[model samples]
Target: IAHGEIFLTTGGRSMDRRQIWSAMKRLCQKAGVAPSKVFPHNLRHLFATAYYRVYHDIVKLADMLGHSSIETTRIYLIESGAEHQRQLERLGLVS
Candidate 1:
């Protein structure tokens, strides 16, 4: 568990789930956003969504996410619908 820090705290120690949740809640409040919309898993989903948008390769995304199946990584793609349409429009493949 070297460094034991997948997510670090302000004091440079590993952050517990509760700490991350609380911090996210606080940030959401300060931003005047719904706290329910902010969670630790959302960060992973955002990263996966951005990476997939650039690569457009699910197999590679699965590898990066250390997932045994692409289906698991697929759960992270929240922008699938609108982003797909935007890509099509950008390519002039559809009006």
Candidate 2:
């Protein structure tokens, strides 16, 4: 039923990065998105960044992201460019 279950049924086969990229491209095309603008890893990055922004709990983010080190999870915070915009807005620098 799940993808992991289907993988097991198919002799535990694993797809290489090229195959994964191809599949992602097809899906992105179907969704009317430019492949260049839709990175597969960005979804994970967005999830981690949003979770940390809402909760501000690094330990919980590390667990959710399956990161062995909290330092690894910190990398996702770098993608939060909107946080800077929010700070500037709060300071009345921008309406």
Candidate 3:
């Protein structure tokens, strides 16, 4: 990795993935969030969901995310039941 790309370091060495994950968990705990709910992979899903919501272009999203199959990218876009309900309500089909 390039020096400019290194964000976290210890004793002149860059932090590994495990160290980054642990640091994120600790930061979340300090912020009154559940450490168990803080994970590195979840950020990828969050980014995918938010990107898809904004652009509504699954093919481009799949390519940007480096997914070989659009099906794999679809997994990242799953929404919560409450969010789905809110979207349906926005349609204003019912009184």
Number of the top candidate by TM-score?
3
RMSD of 1: 3.3
Clashing pairs in 1: none
Clashing pairs in 3: none
lDDT of 1 by residue, 1-95 (tens): 45346778778888888998898899899999998799988877888888888989999989977899988888787556888788888999666
TM-score of 2: 0.60
Tell me the RMSD of model 3 versus the true structure. Answer: 3.2
Alpha carbon lDDT of each predicted model: 0.84, 0.76, 0.85
Q: Which sections of candidate 2 miss by over 4 Å?
A: 1-20, 79-86, 93-95
lDDT of 3 by residue, 1-95 (tens): 53343546757666777987988898998999988899888877888988998999999999978899999999888878999999899999976
| Cand. 3 TM to true fold | 0.75
Q: Encode model 2's per-residue lDDT on 36-93: one tens digit a residue.
A: 9766577678888788889999999999778999999988887456977887788996
Which candidate leads in lDDT?
3
- Better by TM-score, candidate 3 or 2: 3
Give candidate 1 misplaced runs (Cα > 4 Å).
1-6, 78-95
Worst-scoring 10-residue span by lDDT in model 3: 1-10
Better of 2 and 3 by lDDT: 3
